[model samples]
Target: MGAFGRMRNSLSFTPPDLQEARLEPVRRRIVFYIPGYDPEARTRYRLLFVREWTRYTKRFGGGRREISRAELSQDGLVQSWTVSAPEQGDGAETRYDVLLWDDIVARDFARSRFLSVALLIVGTLQTILSGLLFRFYRLSWKYGNVILYPFVMVILLAALSVAIAALVHAHLGDWFGHSLGLPLWVSLPLGVIAGLVWIKAIEAFLNRVFFWQLLNDWVFNWQHGQGRRPDYERRLDAFAEHILSSVAARDEAGHSTDEVMIVGHSSGGLTAAEVAARVLARDTSIGTSGANLSLATLGSGLPLVAMQPAAARLRGEIARLVTDRRIVWCDFHAPQDWMNFPGFNPLHDLKLRLCGQPVANPLVRSARFRDLLCPETYRRVRFRPFRMHFQFLLANERPGAYDFFAMTLGPRRLREQVLAPDAYSEPEPAVPL
Candidate 1:
């Protein structure tokens, strides 16, 4: 009991303000999931969703969580599946479309070692020189460390490798020359060989810890922010078109869809925001097309690129989305996740309202991971940065105000959760007849 109290006290965070409002329950929903900078294909996420959704059902014990077999689109741009819960509310069905861009991420991660390191250096300099790193520190010190991690790790590793090479050259030089009767000059090459071996070992260790993967992510962000990646822009356009088509489609019963939710996690949050803005640009009346349109960005790294001076295009998109107020936007952040910015109101934080028209958006809300997970579970994952970051997309150990499965698959609309989480997250107590 004491441990639990300490856990709660330690992990608690104040959530942003959202007005109370009653929203209609959803009968049919469409979810477009944009993943972060991961090289894995959509199939991996499908399996994870299946696994976690099953766990969610067991934990909450509502009913069977029936998910259809995933189907890949002919164009191979998306993989989709259906989820149904017959006993929840009025019976809800959700179609999930997993947007595919992992191939691009894989290509980024597959670059030559020399090229990758060079890009990392370039990215680090840009981030620091642009004053974005200091701005990040001012916004959230922990998150600033996230941005600094790759560069710091690289420097530390290089120093260690050089020290190892020097030590080998100094101490082992005489011994090797005497043992093999080789010239003392051969020790220099041996030391160089030792340094190379150390570097290889360090590379293996970095791969195991996802350090290189994250470094590549930073490089990708820098490139994408500078508008150097035309591939991303093209993909964003395609994603926008796909969303527009999905929202326009009618169900098998010839009835319009109830709600369309675009969910972006981690770096995908930037992509999701751009996609939403693009959809709005193509069709100004997308929000008023009788379908409830909402965007949910969870543990997003949008600020990483959006905060840069070279990211005016992204800022414009964000401003468009923020000032419009037509589509509902909610950003779910966790204080514990160093990878995301919590308590970030895009309008005020980015001064987007000042950039364009004034309007409040992206009702920033904390995921309250501690409240949702058990004390033991929370303790185990508290220090694991990646796990805590990914927790936004995973199932909670205990039901709470934030449940990814509940928000996406349950009968409630995402708008309701954004507006009045306290009111809509759980059912009210029974009254006497």
Candidate 2:
């Protein structure tokens, strides 16, 4: 029989004795450090033991595998493991055990609660940037006979971006649906043109839309303080300094250390990169001496930065500032993600080029966040290499999320054995353009 034929022969509605995949317990001992001096951050890290243990256990299966033990000291440890399950019907049960550790990842979770909440709110707001920038109609108004109206820049660009995004996403899938049965001339340029137009429209709105109060506050806080934060680069520059100084303090006395890794998700990516850049410029030690300052952007919404009311000088600084050549700037993108860059979202790539190119900073994209929630099966979806954009940052908390995190972000701090490459994916391996 042919390859397709053999697969159909072994079918039965009832459960069979096929070899079931064993659910193994995960173990690791590692030190997780975050840059800062916030008492709040330390508090939040402490709270993580309570939240992560509860969430992961429920998110996956029942609380059979997870085991948690507490410590008397202020700093505690959290250990987790998944127990085996019986194969029955079409589904199975898995247990997780989290054992308390002498240490924790990050810091006081509640202390940085403001930071996390701010980032989440920013994530929600950025979704509306493109939609809010355009005008449906600026036509002249007329009650009796006097009527006048002009298309403003924000409205025009916002509308264009939406229209372009709709058209490309709606049509390109069909055109490329076939195996290039026709020549590439027709569809490739069409896709690029459509994508470019949308990017330009979004960029225009961001560049001119006048900074919204909420955005400025978040940016300000990320740089220094939150919501009350104003639109100033100095605030962010200070923030960069704070994180760097904290990192320096944490470094062991004998070992010479230089850089701090800024790991950001979605909107956090944009804010971190820009703020870090400004910080580096203010102090040569942060940028010039060692390859210390690094950026790891996940599910980026950096284009949101353009939506602010930036000054000519600020724009000039962003447009021309150079990054240390050795700084590692890694980006994770997922093709299956609706909000992820380079798919339905084109703004991310543009922001990177406009900001990253100036400094010759190395830019790399990897595959991530592809598997979606499987509705039909009880088991969560599997991760596809090059596909998990949204969940890459959250992988630390998801099923098999460990393998991906360990390799990309884990090896440095998260100690887990044999992180599987197929568990998730990396992008086209950073090819220079």
Candidate 3:
């Protein structure tokens, strides 16, 4: 059988094997980090994490904690690292693995400009014809603007280019025709050349401002929503298999893991959900394996694709995950981040139905950037949309409930952090012994 066939067969359903849960401080935790559509994430994420974690240590006072060097997997699909912080609550050791898929993103970004613009036009037309554009606006006006920003900019840039070309053509045409006694043909081609030159001139600026990136992002959403991106599904399968292997692998003395957490940021939110669903479907016994499985989606852009009618696969996966009691899911969103959907309920708002009793698997909470950052810092970054969106992953200015480092490296398990009514206040910096 083919690789896809083998994957399908391996995911055949298994019988349920539910068992009692043992919840405690996380000692040996394994984390799978799924990033969004950013092409630079492969190297950028590690550096970003290290920089933010250092900032985190300084702010929260766990200076003694140290992160080990990263080790890449055989297939180069994952970059794994270990973070040991023995001074925290009861001492914790966490292994973090970043699921790599930035290669695909790079390819998308490197495609021909004609193809990119064509895809953008197609995606925009689909959004408009399918009525998703209006629906998106009704759901989140900010998101609606995000969807339209690229198209609008493209149009404005084209208009500006045309205006410049026309002005140049008039001056050149006057010189060539009236003064030099030349034909209109000379000025016409020069006008076209002038327009092309203008577009070429501003290409770097547009890229720096993320114009093409956002266009490609929307195109990805459009293609993936229509089930055209099998590459992403295959990547998710690999991610699921890795998670299952991690769960099944025994330590030196045959000890099971304490917790297995999958963190999905931005568009990766739905990707992480699909991974957990596949794991559960393949082996129902995972729930009884004595390891806590938790899904944490930060600044999740779930609705961007899940709202599409053709995304039945994603919707089904989300449904299965939501009804499952074994895995704990928490979604964090901030009002300041226009890129994410805040206060969204998958079951209620998205209308996903459950087979059995209602399950509130995803405990939705506000990241509350206003509370997480100091007034001065918040004011500086609040207007910056991408900065606010990334705040979910960055270290907090103050000790708040949504500290990424605290939830991942601190002693507390994700479930504990999610269930606690009070904020996760970090301890004072440990004095050197």
* lDDT on C-alpha atoms for all candidate structures: 0.77, 0.36, 0.78
Ranked candidates (TM-score, high to low): 3, 1, 2
Query: Across residues 110-183, which tens digit of lDDT does each residue of candidate 1 receive?
Result: 77877887888888887888777877776667777877888888888778878887777776566644444445
Task: List, residue by residue over 1-433, the lDDT tens digit for candidate 3.
Answer: 5321121111111223222335566778888999998888778788889999877667657747778888889998899888875664565688899988888888998899878888888889888998888767665667778888998987897788788877667776765454443357887677778987888888899887889888988888889999989898899899999988876775444765788889999888777888889988998887655777888998887888888988888888888877787888888877788898666767655767676655747777778889878888988988788888889889777767677887787767776776563744555433321
Selected candidate, larger TM-score, 2 vs 3:
3
| Model 3 bad stretches (over 4 Å) | 1-23, 87-89, 174-182, 251-255, 421-433
Superposition error at 130 for model 2 (Å): 11
> Roughly what TM-score does model 3 have, to 2 decimal places?
0.89
Please report how far candidate 3 places residue 181 from its true position, in Å.
5.3
**Models, CA RMSD each:** 5.4, 21.4, 8.1
